[model samples]
Target: MKALPSSSGSSGEKEASSSLVIALGSSLGATCPSEPPMKARRSLEPVLLAPWGSCLLALGAPASRPTRKSDSFLWPFGMTTALNRGCWHKSLAMMATAIKLAVRALVEVEVRRKSERLALSEAVAELGIRDVRAIGLAHRLVLETLKRLNLLDEVAKAALAGEGSLEDLGARARAFLRLFAYRAVVEGASRRELASFVLSAREALGKGTLRPIERALGRCTTLSLDDVLASRSGDERLALELCVPTWLLRLLCRDLGRQVAIGLLKASLVQAPSYVRVNTLRGEEGEILASLEQEGIVLEPVEGLRHVYKVVEAGKPIILTDAYKEGLVYPQDKASCLAVEVANPRPGQVVLDVCAAPGAKTTYMAQLMGNRGLIISIDFSRRRLGAWRKLVARMGVKVAFPILADARFQLPTRLRADVVLLDLPCTSTGAFAKTPSAKWRLGPRSPKNMAKVQARILRASAEHVKPGGVLIYTTCSLLVEENERVVEDFLRANPDFELERPEPFLGLPGLRGLSKAQRLYPHIHECDGYFIAKLRRES
Candidate 1:
């Protein structure tokens, strides 16, 4: 096998720093707002020696002084090496090897399991007790690699030049090839950067494990986007250029029209805006704004929505701030906030939050209800409820009571509520700007399949809405199958419910004559793609 090219001395530091932010920011988004030069959080985060643990330190989280619990909230942050390059717990040689191995192992596991969340959990578990700054770096690396995986895999098949298929390669080799290809082809890593990666992988994974793909990496680095696109055309060409799936691209074109679909597809390539709902329950908005401002967190209020603000800039990742940790604000999408506002739950009303785990909406409903209503939070996953418990506690949501049960069937609750909020699951095509990996996991039939589940949950949730009460159905999906069609089918069977305009309508009118419903697009709103339908029971 051909060996990796030798590393050159680091030159053009100015160009490298500016390009680093733009390259890594593709999927890591608001994690680093413009990636201004900054330091690691003041305290030294524990840098464990696990393979992935070492990788976590690759981005310059000081491997020095032990951090206190109060100082140790791990969250994704800017991965600029300029931050902690001087304070590594180990030698650069070792950290480089750790980085290579960590990416390979995580990518391999993610490919095998088909779940980025699970893959991250395994890596984090192996990390032991360290600040997960490096883990966050690793996660961002994996996400970007995965986000552009469709394009990477297509180029790989061509780069092999028929000697072998990607499927024939060993899983670890496949993982390594994809990771480096992403760095070189997509992010345009320098020869020094690519050489360091190869040498590091050789040391960590052994030359034997990566030997099969060395030549492929060499071939891949020489190829251009046009070279990869030469053999493809039309939907296929656009899909490759956009790094989206062929079938999904066709669907978006058909549903959203070619121009609008292209706009939405292009939006997924860049960072999405991050938003937070100020929890007025904990403190007044004015005082909270001053505190966040003092901490170097900047904000711009979203018009038409009370207590919601777009993060204009931040000194660090929002989740790491004292305001976020204290639960003074909730990181929620603007589309999500619009749904809660549409529901407009009143104080003292009984509301059932179906499938409400990790409680952004549930907590927001409490905020609107002024903590006076009873919100019965229902979800099937015990693990999710556990998280929901912590989130609700942090948000100071006193009105919500959790129950573990599937909303697809009859809910366990016997009492009816004045409001039933169904933030049902979907293919998540609209939220791709934030979670681009989800688009790859979906299939052509994925929407219809999810629609079936959503239909069941909606019917069950509709069972709990009292007469004259409101039933709000929402999804982070632009497809009609999951939104208007489901609502249309529900209305056909249950004539007692009539569609009503959501106050402060923020999106386009729904399709198929469901004009009362609303649809929000990322291209139009600069937010997650969403569909919201409100039905008032007339019985």
Candidate 2:
């Protein structure tokens, strides 16, 4: 929760700035050509409020005149606060109480009826917020918290015993759950504040309070807000521990076994390490590391992850560093960087990154090829591609050509590629730590649905690969259905493509009969849960 220092007028700013950039730049010396000034895209803030109207404003989105389409986008930006002259929304201090309530309510409902997406969306709509992104964020927070607490069914029964239908109680539960989550998880507000936050919740969910809930709070050691946060053994206690829901824990046990699930849950609670890939197209790794050292950013080498550095300290957002602004380095996950290594892009190789957007892998592959080959990056989303363009511009990627197209359909007539990287979308179970909300939105049916879509995307991408070229399939999900199982299904249907071992060895070997496929997990490898396999076209 520490605020970033402004670069304006600090006496030591100049010296600190250069030192920081140098430390960052040293990692990019092997790939990039020259050091450049830093420019950063601001990350969305930690606290978000539901908007009063449809327009959604990003936590740090600069103040400006309202637009006509604002109503349609409300759920994404969140509801702004009325108290601070439009200056303040919710702050990060209220987490303890908000998270606990949100989890308690969400888990209770999900365990009973399931499938509440539409009801939640409608309730958020009434709140006049249109920003789907913020809605998604808030929804995820409640869902993840519930899953962590093992009270999904308990909370649902408490929230909806009388409502009798998903459509009837869904919105009411979501609104109430959001308030409770905000008070517990994000605001860390105490029981008294928790009572206040649930004012709206009380009106919508008028069921009699559970006697257990009453006794649990009555036994609190003190009435003070901090005491409520520190109280043990209620649903709130579970929120503080941040454990995965008992059901999810059981599901994980069924798949990866109890030991691995416990290990992963422990890992999920740990703060994700910050890692960035030095743009090899800009300079060599040695020179980049030295340059970054001169700039004062502290970094440590990650074992087995080439061109990746973990940030220990920083003077400014790395994006503002001259090295980053000039496309000398890009922030990417270490596991994702490994996928390109498996692709083995040669200098003249023609590569295709299907589903490429926000361009991390696209740019990384271009750098791997020394900017000498053609790389066509295709995605169905134009807006996402526009964002990718911004990254390409910032990262100084020159060889990649981004196209707007769906991977489930036929590729363009001239779409053949030497290396096709099919990083198709999946359940994203591996990214639970980064995206805590998916646990709520997901179900047993998620993998089956996602696998079907992935199979289509994979087949389309595979068709575009040139004879004897390599096709790399990957996902950020650990599910066997989404990972090895999908690959097995594809392999059975396509005889010309043979599975190949991953290069540079970033992940552990895969499971079942697809052991040649590479899989990385946060619990085991301390990286995003990822699955990657290389397939060679025998021709």
Candidate 3:
């Protein structure tokens, strides 16, 4: 919904940046295929990714990354100066290998035009780097770097005065600089430590012919984040501190109040807890818990919901374990589980899932329905729907049938359903912690533009809700334009629909007196920022 951010490249360079964004959803993955990929590009444009399944996947979910207790994950604001088990590796051999390969991986990642996302963990896993820690180290390096990218660029541009601009550099050079900035600013690496990592870039950036890169690296070491902040105040300082765009941060401060907005932004930097719902379709709840416990996944039951639990820690990456393969557990955020609970579909009912893909909510809905109801899942991308179908099949969902259709226009069928779930695409403002790249991908007008798309989808979806049936509208966004405003526009046009209280309301009341709608914040709820409203067709 937002245009990709890039330097003022040539027409060709602009197209290439746009192309890579369309081809790949994240540096690790791609969502939709809106444009063809070109082999070279320095900038990236993010497409409308299927946010259902990989809600946390894009954020990260390889067990090797290691997290903290209570799903209140304590990811460091910046990595440590030297080697630690979690940050850079102590072994020079491993650090050199990780740095060399990571730089190459990042450069290639910029130009790749894949149809689906390749998780950084998975990408590193494929690099023939035989060591497990090396792969994990590379993923952390890239992931944290991308999260702080905006701030990195701000500091970089200033440090680059008279040295040349990041936009003017080649893709490899730009990628290396971003990596170097992450180490310097985020990790607070020393001159000696920075030098160690810089040496590895020679192998990735033209094999010892990187005089320009080396010269720039010298400037990067002298840059201090504090020095960068000294000249700014208000949201300007907070923007760099949080590594979010000043525009978005300004909007949040205005809407949520400065302190509340700052708290939310700060929480996003710390990875939220990974949550999973026990698939009752595969086995009884007790048996599934026992199985997960046997596999060393320590889970704490989340209050106010059934079947959803916070994954405190896991012995191994949950996906790699038999439980996931067997579809006994689903990796989901607790806030996502809350949206599904509010929908509360029943057995034998006909449900329409608009923009459903990658099948997180569809599968969960089927699990609650006892696989007895019919769910017609509609999504724009055939690729995403195919993914949904496969996921449902794995999760033992027999009632879901996928249909390829866009929700922005009229439907292809005349069927009205007992429930209509429109978890349509939005700015993904709420899930920024999970996918930090999204923060930079958006523009000032992005939310207002996305609200238009959400409004259209909501109008079309409401038509399919039978009289007295419920239409559950939800988005992983905090912006009112995409949530409350869209709902307000729909309610004004369609007088028959009225907001109803969502059950087990765990979040704060929605703004503008839409108390029937609930809002969840990462700072307060320890979950993704999300909005949920269940509307009843009152005719």
Candidate 4:
């Protein structure tokens, strides 16, 4: 092992001497001869009296090994002066213990929450762990465990057959078991590797508390995921295979054809590529591209879009890059950029962004408007609008004002705008690749419930559009109820507004005779699944 950097000459010498003592003790224990050559005895003297000698003694090295001024000691193990093997193993074990504890803590919090699901990022922030690498590993473990939660539960059930159901296990115990089973079955960890992880879990969660799981872990390793997937058929089989809920799979099949639905489901299992829009407020396209490239972030311009680029390679997290910190680039998805493009807000138009928070589309619209137009951004939650304020400020957007109001009821201001953007909340089925947790959180009634909310917001937003002004409705959802159905109902009730083809026509035509509207699918677009429709108030 490489010696750690020392503070000064004296400390360096001491560390070297201490390392030597540890090496000698490991090679020759208490049975070492009492007398040695004069040179060896003097060399070993300072090491024997050093503080590290106590550590060697504690690690099962004979207590007398450090006390004796030995001369006749035999270097049976070649007197290697590297770090002790047992100490290295113990250090690794401690690291694993910390990670398991962090994962368990996050999982427990998520499981216990009733109304609000704690985001992984928020959970990780609360951990207060100082080690960046360990935090990243724990974050990855939590995500993987949650992504395959249903499958893990099934595996755990089979493993715990005749013992107790997975529901009977306590939250912490269930978290630990899900994590372990994911590694053992999905990751294909060996029985011995899993046993070590379980031992670490036992130390963190108490041996008695983890006893039932310890017995079940052996059975967990013996099970095959293929067998579990093979047991189900059709939608059930697809759900297990893709780690999606059966209800979601059936819904997708009903909306999109079976082949297309399966494709979307499979695509959701993979991580989506990062896409960003150059902040024209700060720099020109060429300037931002050159700046990001200098930072080792190469971006490919998205086809048919000017400002949007797919991050081909980012040396680090793109958000942390100097280009990003300087507010030269805003990470917005390609499909999302398509909606703002279709809206085509001019430099001096008044745009109202209903349901604007965490302001991706709002900022993008501001960028397109050349920071010269008035944008009234409104959302129901003040907390989310606070984030919008930060994003607007970061992007140097001066023309946008944020309002805290529920768009479903009415707009905060009486002023009608040239363009009204209603990006309503709905079942986020399209963006599942990026947000797997949302898949399990949604239920059968989610689309219908969300459609009702979307319809109210759409009708309220329609009242805010000026004569002949465009009302752009969009959502990151593939469900027809939230997309086509909502728009169809809105147009039926309001004769003045009619659906028109979104400009720069990117994405496939919408379903249910709403062909003028556009839909982007994850499998086809290589971006989040999304829907965009442009309606003109003819009056």
Candidates 1 and 3 compared by TM-score, better number: 1
Over 461-505, each residue of candidate 4 has an lDDT whose tens digit, in order, gives 888899989999989999998899999988889999988988878
Whole-model alpha-carbon lDDT for candidate 4: 0.67
Cα miss at 484, model 4 (Å)? 0.8
Task: Using lDDT as the measure, name the better of candidate 1 and candidate 4.
Answer: 1
Cα RMSD (angstroms) for every candidate in the order listed: 11.5, 14.5, 11.7, 15.7
Q: How many backbone clashes does candidate 4 have?
A: 4
Listed in order, each prediction's TM-score against the native is 0.82, 0.63, 0.80, 0.80
> What's the true lDDT of residue 530 in model 3?
89
lDDT digits (tens) for residues 299-368 of candidate 2: 8878876688887766544655677767777667788888887887988888998878768888888877
Off by over 4 Å in 1: 1-114, 129-133
Name the regions of candidate 4 deviating beyond 4 angstroms. Answer: 1-118, 190-209
- How big is the RMSD of model 2? 14.5
Q: Scored by CA lDDT, what does every candidate get?
A: 0.70, 0.57, 0.68, 0.67
Q: Roughly what TM-score does model 2 have, to 2 decimal places? A: 0.63
**Candidate 4: lDDT of 416?**
87
Q: In model 1, what lDDT does residue 102 have? A: 52
lDDT of candidate 2? 0.57
Give the C-alpha lDDT of model 1. 0.70
